[model samples]
Target: MTNIAPPLVLTVAGSDSGGGAGIQADLKTMLAHGVHGMSVIAAVTAQNSRGVQGYWELPPEAVRAQLDSVLSDIGVHAVKTGMLASTALVETVAEVLAGAGAPVVVDPVGVSKHGDALLEPSAVDAVRTALLPVATVATPNLWEVEQLTGVKVVDEAGMREAAEAVKALGPRWALIKGGHLPGEPADLLFDGTREYRFTAPRHDNRHTHGTGCTLASAIASNLALGADVPDAVARAKEYVTGAIAAGFPLGTGIGPVDHGWRQRAALDQSRS
Candidate 1:
């Protein structure tokens, strides 16, 4: 028999004890997309569906060692970063990923779904300077757009402006998510030239805990499988939209999107 290789997608992010976001969500998304997932934990958070109570950033050396061990061994085809809690951690991770030779998805995670701050104010400059330039695509929610590029997004026009502003920071492309915007949930994608709008009817659900991390990971997984930028984003949008729609009630507060919604559906179908 011929040897089989799994496409590896690496997540350099924090740990959400609740398993709704961060590394938990990233790994789940990779598995759902049929890719192997690896992780380099940057921070650990005492968090749950209710909110983040506390967090601790890991030492830069430890973070570096983890990245080195992975890249030197199992290797990675794509990378997605979330919750770089400090400037030091951001810089360290950037250095590790600088020559990764794989598509990088930077999700500028500023706050949690429950409004808890994850990225530090001091780290914003480091992320913009070190990571953004190396990213294949930078994914930022509207709040993160403002936090990273100082571009306040009030409407659709502002969203386009935010995407352009972020693209100017040297990333090949930028995705400005407008889920926080009122009315229809839409996300804008631009590469300093063409634009694509991804929209979905609002799910009217309060359980969207890990949507950002999930989307980025799905994009990374598709990219690892050789999909180009536009096709990767389009497929990722479809996967995440279905995840949000199939999200179930969990915990006492907010819950996670159903990363394995398709698996659950298949099981139901088999039972019929």
Candidate 2:
């Protein structure tokens, strides 16, 4: 007899040497949700808690070949994309996923945790036109929301408008993360007719390095496991909140949230 799972998630993103965000964070978030995760590296970044120093975007053929290899065998239940550095890479990935027929979570990553540019200006239109239209949900930070749609989000109120602007791009849903705003950390999800707000008390800790990647990956995992978009967003928000509260200090600069904080708790409970 064989026991097999029903769903799997694919992350098409970049490698973060720092392990705080990008591909590393996506995989960690998937595992934390009890889902199998696979990745296609689109770029390699020299990064740390402080910032990104350098990056190299992989060739489009290499990116497509990786995606094809994964899809031909292992197969995917859902897909999430982040840090596609160039217009060409974005087009290639869009073409591949367009036929993959899996629910996709597109995180239009514009800047890093330390405010470094991750996406090229030339890629913005490609991302909006090619990638987002095929997405089940488009997750963008406030900065990204502005860059992609010219929608400025200064508060929770502005998130709705930003989400609508992003939804106009063709995604079924848009999650505009409001953690960058002053006050509590809140996220807004809009799907044309309805809106949902996910709010949590802002943790004072300065170690939130991978929150965006983590949230989007978590949502993708849930979707792969058959949860609907709103439910997925709600659960991802809760998980990230816990991770933030349990974040650990790493390098001398900003640090990463604890992706396996739940595992640590379970271990402590067993010992007790």
Candidate 3:
């Protein structure tokens, strides 16, 4: 008998003690996509459904060591990054990723779901100059779009401009998420000349934490499984839409989207 391995995906991000977002969400999403998930923790947060209280960033040397250890040994097929909390960490991760021979999904995480600051104010420039340039796909929500490029997306029409501004920052594809806009959730994907729009019915759930981290990891997983940039985003959108719709309450505040929604749905269908 022979044993086979699943596609490998790596996440470089912070840890959410609440287990609803950050590395936890990333790994759960990778597992849901049937991929081997690996992580390089860049920071750790004292966080929960209520909000982020505080965060501590790891040293650049520590982050670099983890990256080297993983890439030199169990190489990844795709990589996703989130919540690099400082300028040094951002630069360190970006430098190593510039040489990593895998598709990279860069989620420019600026703030938490409760509006707590995650990335340092000083790190914003590093993210724009160093990190975004090396990304295969940069997934920025409407807030992140403004943070990174000063492009505010108020309507669907404004998302194209946001996409173009993000594309100018050097990512091969810029996925400007328009979920914050006053309509059905929509995201625009652009690669200089071509464009793709993805939309899903809006779920009326406030417990939709971890949406960004989960979506980016799903995209990385799909890419590791050999989907092209557009297809990867499309697949990720569907998975996250289901998760958001199935979100549940927790911790007396906003809870997380169900990373295992697909599995639960399948089990229920089989039983019925």
Candidate 4:
């Protein structure tokens, strides 16, 4: 049999010391989806189960160098960005992504799981004006949507308005996450014309530390493997729902969803 290489997916995000979110979560999600994952470490966060203690962003020149090295040589099938702390870094990443041949997923991460500010308030404008227009899909949770567009979504019906607000920012598609809503979790995907709504049984677990990152990365992975935007979002929702169900506790605080929940289930079944 011939060796088949996996689709190459690149994530330009921060590093989570706890191995739950950021670069760690992205790589794990890619591996689970059988994609070759690459990274351009945009920032480094000293975080754990409780919360983010602190973070330091890499220099813009250094970030540019890494991006150039990756794109000039081993090109990517898809790109995803998260936790670009400052305005300068976001501007730099947007510049590079604007010229990228692959589909781009932008997760406008405003705050961390522990409620710490990740992106600077001043940088929100940059994300909306510069970064979003280049995105194939922009995945913003309720809080992030409110942060970016000043639209607060309390119910499923409100997600559409939020989606419109985001699409107006110029992405080819927009996915407004309604996981923060009460009742069942619903996500709305719109491509300026049609709308796709995905709802999953809300997992009861509270240790959903990296759900946003996982969902966005999964979408990128699926896109790398040739799924359309709607199909990609649908598949990603299923994966994240399972991962959320398999979430286990860590430390004294919230934990991350099991990125390899499917593999773990398969292993358990085989042993049984």
Candidate 5:
């Protein structure tokens, strides 16, 4: 009998000790999308449902070594990056990824769910100059859009401007997430020439801790599975919407969207 291997997806991000966001969420989302997830932890955080207490970044050389190890041996079909805390780490990862030959999904993680800072302010410029240029898709929330490009998105009408601003920063495609807007949650995708919009009913759930990481990982997973940019973003948005709707409370703070909501839903349906 022949064995088939699943597509390999890599995540370069920080580790959340709470297991709700960052590396943990990335891997869980990848699994939910049926892809093999590999990680190169850039930083480690003493974090939980309440907030991030502190974070320690690994040495740049160690991060580079891990990237080389993975790229040289196992390789990758797609890559997603989140919370690369410092300037050195951002530049190092960007250098390696420039030659990785895989679709890159960048989640410009600036702050945690509880408003704790994730990326250093000094590193923001590095992210724009060194990292975004290599990204196949750059996913930024409204706040991140302003942080990166100074384009503030207050309504759905402003998403197009934000997406264009992000695209001008050098990403092949820019996805401006408008979940913070007043109405329904919507995201705009732009690649200079073409545009796409993805929307889902706004869930009133507050336990949406890992939404950003989950969405980016799902996009990477779909890309690894051979979905084009628009198709991947569309599928990822759908999956994350379901997860958010099924979100359950955890600890005393915001919880994570259910990464395995689809699986649980399937099992429930079968039993019924």
Candidate 6:
């Protein structure tokens, strides 16, 4: 058999002990895209379906060491970032990611599904100044948009305004997730010169714990496979839409979007 290696993608994020989000979700999403996934754990969270109990970030030097170990050897085709809990961690991760040749997908993860703060308020400015500038694409949900850009996204028009605000912060592209909006879930992507909007039927499932992390990682995987920014977002939109539909309850609280839902379906059909 020919030894063929898959496209490699890296997720620089926190670890979710619950296995629903963070580094776990990112790696699962990457595998669903048929790419190799690597991780640099910036923090560790004691979380479950109900909520995040507590978290601790690794030292800046430790973070830098892990990043260097990965990028210098196993080298990634694309990168994705999530949950740098504090300002110093954010700055450290930003400095490390600033020079990587791969495209970077920055997910401004603010809180967990159960409303626990993941990134500190003080880190918001660091994300805007040090991190967003290095992003090939920045993914921010409505609440995060408000947090980072101070833009109140009240309606579709507000979504556009938020995208512009995020673009102004220096990312090459902005993906303003309007999933919190009423009716259907939609996301708007803008790159100054052009824009793309993606909408999916709102699934009634409440198990959407890792949707943001999964979507951002999927985009990184697609980018690693050589898709352009807009196309990568579109493909990720489709994947996450299906994952949302397939979401199932895990623990007492909101569960997770099924990363292997497609494969699970196929297996079920075969057995049937």
Candidate number of the best lDDT: 3
Model 6 lDDT per residue over 1-272, tens place = 89988999999999999999999999999999999999999999999999999999999999999999999988889999999999998998889888898999999999988989998888889999999999999999999999998899988877889999999999999999999888777899999979899988998899998999999999999999999998999999999999999998998998999999989989999999
Which 10 successive residues of model 1 have the least lDDT summed?
A: 245-254
The residue ranges of model 5 lying beyond 4 angstroms of the native Cα positions read none
Overall lDDT per candidate, in order of appearance: 0.93, 0.93, 0.96, 0.95, 0.95, 0.93
Candidate number that wins on TM-score, 1 or 5: 5
Q: Where is model 1 more than 4 Å wrong at Cα? A: none
Residue-level lDDT tens digits of model 3 in 1-272: 99888999999999999999999999999999999999999999999999999999999999999999999999989999999999999999999999999999999999999999999999999999999999999999999999888988788989899999999999999999888888787899999999999999998899999999999999999999999999999999999999999999999999999999999999999999
lDDT of 2: 0.93
Clashes of 1: 0
Q: Give the TM-score of candidate 3.
A: 0.99
Q: What pairs collide in candidate 6?
A: none
- Cα lDDT tens digits, model 5, 1-272, are 99887999999999999888999999999999999999999999999889999999999999999999999999999999999999999999999999999999999999988989899999999999999999999999988999999988778999889988999999999999989899878899999999998889998899998999999999999999999999999999999999999998889988889999999999999999
Local accuracy of candidate 4 as per-residue lDDT tens digits, 1-272:
99977999999999999999999999999999999999999999999999999999999999999999999999999999999999999999999999989999999999998999999989999999999999999999999999999999989889999999999999999999998888988889999899998999977799898999999999999999999999999999999999999998998899999999999999999999
Give per-candidate clash totals: 0, 0, 0, 0, 0, 0
Q: Each candidate: RMSD to true structure?
A: 0.9, 0.9, 0.7, 0.9, 0.7, 0.9
Clashing residue pairs in candidate 5 (N, C-alpha, C atoms within 3 angstroms): none
What's each prediction's TM-score?
Answer: 0.98, 0.98, 0.99, 0.98, 0.99, 0.98
